[model samples]
Target chain A: EAGVTQSPTHLIKTRGQQATLRCSPISGHTSVYWYQQALGLGLQFLLWYDEGEERNRGNFPPRFSGRQFPNYSSELNVNALELEDSALYLCASNDLGDYGYTFGSGTRLTVV
Target chain B: AQSVTQPDIHITVSEGASLELRCNYSYGATPYLFWYVQSPGQGLQLLLKYFSGDTLVQGIKGFEAEFKRSQSSFNLRKPSVHWSDAAEYFCAVGARSRGYQKVTFGIGTKLQVIP
Candidate 1:
């Protein structure tokens, strides 16, 4: 079985621009999670999608949002990106209510 | 509110030396604890987790962690370190409350191995 997969391995966007990152969950997985690993900020949870529904989100601003498709794939969109938005955005998948999550390689977003 | 803290920002250990990374968490109920390793420019990998039952849990790559509820700590340990062990290690805590699984990760500790 394939693990979680993410598209656009790297991205470079200017400030005030918008960015969209994508993720596909593993086979038979129904939950997708998004996390941001910023420099010196560690890994922060961005959003959680389960069964095609937004379940939970972190303390991030409203400009940071995402959604999950019926196939359990997810897309994270950042509007009005700032230089601090430069970070590795990771996607993880797991069975609903499962304790463990398998993560993807992540998309490195660089906001210039 | 749940939070995890890894007091050590970075640690350097000689090859073949013992290693221990400390992790502390604050939660009211029994928290699900985990340890993850991330290589340079790579995603995080699960090392091990502590849900219940055994206080000591063994993980892949000859790593292990002991959960001390009284001390509110779950520290990762290895008998001998290898150069390959040099990476960023993260400690995470998850709550199984309200039928939701929300995990909180620590600030992470970067390990440097000296050969």
Candidate 2:
């Protein structure tokens, strides 16, 4: 089966602009998660979506938001991007009954 | 809240030498522990996970981790270091939250294998 896939491997946006990243989870997966892997901050949980509902979110500001589509695909939106907002955004999905996740290659967003 | 801690920011060992990476976690109950390896510009790959029943869990790519509930630790170990093993390894913990399970990852420990 195909693993989780992310589009626009690289994205460049100016400060104060908005950016969107997309992810397609593996087949049969229902839970999608977003994480920001900054230079040294590691994987900071951004959002969690299950069954097309936002289940939980991290401590990030409201500018960081995302949604899960009916097909289980997910999109992460970063509004009013700041220089610190530049990082690799990763998407993962699990069966909801499992203990592990399959991650996408991630979208490298660069805010200049 | 669930969290993971990888005390070591980086580690270096000679090829064929043994290796160990420390990880500590905090959670309210028995947590689901996991180890993932991430190559440069690549996504993370699950090395192994400990759900229950066994303290020692074997993972792909010749990796293994032991879960110590008393110490609240799950450390990854490899019998022999391989050059290809040079990468960032993240320790994670998963716990029930908001009617669903949420995972938290550590800052990650970068491994350097030398000849």
Candidate 3:
């Protein structure tokens, strides 16, 4: 089975600009999660969407927001990007009630 | 709030040598545990997980982790290290309550293999 898929392997944006990253969950998966991995840092949770609802979010600012679509695909939007916003944004999916997650390769966002 | 700790920032091991990476967690209740590996420029990959029952859990790529409730620890181990095993590893904890589960990940440990 195909694992989670993300678009735009790499993205470059300037400070104060906005960026959008997309993810497509694995087939039959209902939960999509977003994570950010800054350079030399671990994955930091961003948001969680299940059944078309925003279930939870991390400590990130409101500028980091996203939503899940009816088809279970997801989009992460980062507004007012700063140099610190540069990171690899990952997307993961899992079946409802399942603990394991399959992650996407991630979009490498570079904010200048 | 739940948190995971991976004390080792980096570790070096020779090929064919046994390897162990430590992890500890702080949670109010029993937490689902997991280990994930990420090669450079790649996404994280699940190595193994422990929900309950057996303390020892085997995972892909010949990796395994042992959960110790007394220590509140889950350490990943490989009987024989391979050069390909060099990657960043993360330990995570998931709280299963309130009709949902929220996961928290560690800072990660980077493994270096010397051939």
- List the global CA lDDT of all models: 0.95, 0.94, 0.93
Q: List, residue by residue over A1-112, the lDDT tens digit for candidate 2.
A: 9999998899999999999999999999999999999999999889989999999898999999989999999999999999999999999999998877999999999999
State model 1's lDDT.
0.95
Best-fitting candidate, measured by lDDT? Answer: 1
Report the C-alpha displacement of residue A92, candidate 2, in angstroms.
Answer: 0.2
Report the alpha-carbon TM-score of model 1 versus the true structure.
0.97
lDDT of 3 at B48: 97
Task: Estimate, for each residue in B1-115, the C-alpha lDDT of model 3 and write its tens digit.
Answer: 8999999999999999999999999998888999999999999999999998989999999999999999999999999999999999999999876777788889999999998
Docking class of 1: medium
TM-scores of chain B alone in all candidate structures, in the order given: 0.98, 0.98, 0.97
True contacts kept of 1: 0.59
Model 3, span A1-107: residue lDDT tens: 98999999999999999999999999999999999999777888899999999998988999999889999999999999999999999999998789968899999
Candidate 3 has an interface RMSD (Å) of 1.2
Give the alpha carbon lDDT tens digit for every residue of B19-107 in model 2: 99999999989999999999998889999999999799999999999999899999999999899999999999988766688888999
**Among all windows of ten consecutive residues in candidate 2 chain A, which has the lowest summed lDDT?**
A94-103
